[model samples]
Target: MTKNGHRPKIVVIGGGTGLPVILKSLREKNADITAVVTVADDGGSSGIIRDYVNVVPPGDIRNVLAALSELPEIYLDIFQYRFDTSDRFFAGHAIGNLIIAALAEMKKGVFASVQELSEMMRVDGHVFPVADEPLVLNAEFSDGTFLAGEAEITAARKSIKRVWVTSNEKNEAEMPAAVPEVVEAILGADQIVLGPGSLFTSILPNLVIGNVGKALAETKAEVVYICNIMTQKGETEHFTDADHVRILNAHLGQCFVNTVLVNTAQVPEGYMDKEKYDENLVQVEHDFNGLREQHCRVISSNFLKLKNQGVFHDGNKVVEELMGLVGRPNHELRHREHS
Candidate 1:
């Protein structure tokens, strides 16, 4: 707990729609949040911006800002508003994305831009880019395949063997390192949370950064992984809850997660509108025995929310579980090895 009170310093690590979903609730809880978002995105508005600006993608950062923002709805609406297809001059570009791009140029880096914007947006917490600059996500699949962008990797739809990160710039000699503040946030937090996003892409992209993974391994803070409600098509099409933890453990080089939140509520068959919400998603299955084998303190619940024919983790329900652990670390050393 901070000198201010018992409000826990929470560092959320991941990117994608799932991130903002939970963040909005955490803000209401008045927890000190530091969202360490992925920079490996190479799709849609973010990809286009990165290509032209040579900066970290801003899409995920933009959504997170909105979630943590206390600004009036109209300002957020204008910030998020995307131009219509007919408007070629600004088509498909979000106003927020452009502002972030411009901010990156004005401030000279993604780190500073996010720092400045967080204040402007009246954000309740911190937002850190996973790295100092833009990074390209690279992957090797079990079928001996290779792909470079996050979009391309997912489009290939092969079983991913592992994923890694490197600077997006040409002639870069080494893998990129996570910004120091992000690692500090991880180490300083009372609790650390991962996922509810694409396991290999949105979530793993941040962890694959050497320093970020190192910090996670060494941090005494209690680590919680909120398992995704659905398996993605090109990613974890048939992955069990245990598979998710296994991949995270495999990448980090240890089984460090202290708790695994699994959704037990079933999705009604044919309830998902596949065409509308296509990420090749299916309800995730749980291997309780396997999770126990990983020594994970499993917390299963009906974390299901059906909104617009899509399956999502109920944000309120998820937060309720997280609050139970606020300012609490290693209350029971049943899972992870006691350091």
Candidate 2:
């Protein structure tokens, strides 16, 4: 509960490994959490399943569900279990992904199916897909070349100039719009969080959806961007934290981010296992003046958690700062209070 004696409604938008870490902590804090996940994944198990089944990729959604689920650990473990390569038929697919795929077929759509499964799993809060259907992420590189699909875009590794989404279906009349529930959640949220995930893929895919972007621009929520702790090699190599914000604002056509949470703790040299976490390149360089020029409030702290030689945000510390932003006035008033 906040100072007002009410649960603060937080809508976290993004998908990938990073999103769930924050969600699990938020659940512990008892915030009203809504996870708006990206549907633009086209890699690994998700890619294979989405291709054959004609359903939205379930990998990201499966992880988010597990993060917020109230089920026993054993049950969740079973749900999350991945098949071994020896099992050729089910190889590489998590049980939860298959289950979500089945539910999608039974429920006729991903949106309704997630809600039904959320109830069954006794999820602590809402989990909404950015759109009801699969969205293909398309990108234009600085070289003026174009590519489609998240995997290919990342692999091409050219500097990303911009990204947008299109319906996966052929002959689609128009670009996909986010379902009403997603937009409503954004508009009604007390606080909205953008990332801790891939800048062009996980995070931008959700925002490129037409209605989702519109609602974000129009909503009164204090939008917060949890900047990525490290630069992704293929996606954001040599990029500063402000470059991440700049890309997001460039895509959205407005500086929708109100505050940015940056990790100040340094990762000891040679600590990260490069072979295992190959995607991560280095710590994200800070550009406070650039962030200020973008009109974003900067909150820098030791939000780092080093585990198994990987650097990530310390969820509890990040959430503490997020909760502080709740019910607070604009930056001017906040500055006055500090002064």
Candidate 3:
């Protein structure tokens, strides 16, 4: 419950771009939102920062902060600004990411720094990293080979057999567990959202944490998976809606997802600019029968939003369905309080 009163607590567990899209919508609905972000990224500016500071990559964290921040437009813009490539010193870095890195050093941990920053940004919700320590994503390819690091795994272009996270490069057995707050948030949530992000890299990196995976299986909360809008190349290249959910079950060792939100909207033939939407390899074919066979309640809709020829989930539409799934809110009381 918020200081205002009772509100639906929705814990969204995933990282990357999709997490923030839904979050931006849910914030307006006054839900007590908690985002459990993945920190397994080892590419681009995040990887650079991680190598330098030994703190969890702050790129995803920075995006989540911008999404949930109730700050002025200019401030958020400046926070998100990335320097030009020609600028050697600051090129490829988001200002918000740098701020988070500084805070991590000052507070002695990522969690405390985020907690303090959330208040400073006047965030309407809580943001928790999946693990307190840095987690390196490791994958076994379908061809019986192995790879480490998120960038390498994706670039290999082989079908992913399975993925897991560990804290140490020297010892694979040393996997970091999820912080207590992360598990507690999922266990106590009224609703939990699984994805809309990269199946292997963005989403799994978070769930591969031992306690986070276990909590999903044990939590009584309605676990709703917002299926990805488009198939991701080198990851979910030929995956179906059911395949996505199946991967989640396999990772967690149980069929934990209670509901699946899928997009029924069709993408025009060759409408997607391959250069623009590089990762979007194909439309995820619907497998309603397979979902039913897996005991999942499927709710399909035209939940599509096209921008620059890239397919994205209609965040507002999806949240409406989620809100209804959790039961009707006390609109009169909520309105009174907000007003």
Candidate 4:
């Protein structure tokens, strides 16, 4: 609980592998968590499912649900199980993704379906899709050329100028608006977190939703951006920590980020398995001065955890810093006592 004896309300807005890592840690904290996940994914199992099923991509949402679930490990393991290549019909698709897709079909909307599933799974907190329908992520490259679809954008291997989302439905006359629950979560949050994911594809896709961006800019909560530890090859190559913040601010036309969490611990030479984690190019260089110019408080720490020859944020350390920012210095101690 917070100093005032109420659980702090935190809204984490992003998608991809990073969001779930933080959500798993946040589940143990004395906070009311709301994960506003992106619906713009169009790759691998998600893309194939979207094309055939005509539903919002469920891969990221499936992961987030698993992270916050209170179900037994064995049940979750089964839910997360993926078919082998030998099973050609269901190959490469996780059972959880297929479940979410089925629910979307039955419920008639992704947002409502997620809520129902969250309850059945005994999720610790809320999981909201940024929009009710699938959104196609479109980008304008630095060379002034345009590309549509997340997969193609990344495959082009060109510097991205900016990105936005459009309705995947045909003849849709309006830009997609975020569900009321998502905007309410952001506006009522005690703290809001942006990203530790792909800058343009994962994070921006959600923010580019008109209402979501408006709610973020109007929210009174402190917005904290968890900067990516490594630069992504196709999206943010040769970028610094401040460059990430700069692009975010440029997209919103305001410095919405109040703080930035940066990883200072360096990966030893030849530590990362390049073949496996090929998307990551190098550690994100710091530009404290640039961050200062954006009026963001820079919190530098060894928020690094290397495992399986890959680099990632130390979830415990990141959540510790976040709890402190939310005025819960004794939260860890209290949690330990209870445990």
Q: Write the per-residue lDDT of candidate 1 for residues 24-63, one digit (tens) a residue.
A: 8887788889999998898998998888897899999999
Q: Please give, for residues 56-151, the per-residue lDDT of candidate 4 as tens digits.
A: 999999999999999999999999999998899999999999999999999999998999999999999999999999999999999999999998
What Cα-based lDDT does every candidate model obtain?
0.88, 0.91, 0.86, 0.90
Query: Best TM-score goes to which candidate?
Result: 2
Q: Where in model 1 is the C-alpha error above 4 Å?
A: 1-5, 327-339
lDDT of 2 at 283: 92
Please give the TM-score that candidate 4 achieves against the real structure.
0.96
lDDT of 3 by residue, 141-160 (tens): 88999999999999988999
Better of 1 and 4 by lDDT: 4
What are the RMSD figures for all models against the true structure? 2.2, 1.9, 5.4, 5.0
Off by over 4 Å in 3: 1-5, 169-171, 328-339
lDDT of 3: 0.86
Best by lDDT: 2
Model 3 alpha-carbon miss at residue 200, Å: 0.7
TM per candidate comes to: 0.96, 0.97, 0.94, 0.96
Provide backbone clash counts, one per model: 1, 0, 0, 0
**Over 4 Å off in model 4, which ranges?**
328-339
Give candidate 3's TM-score. 0.94
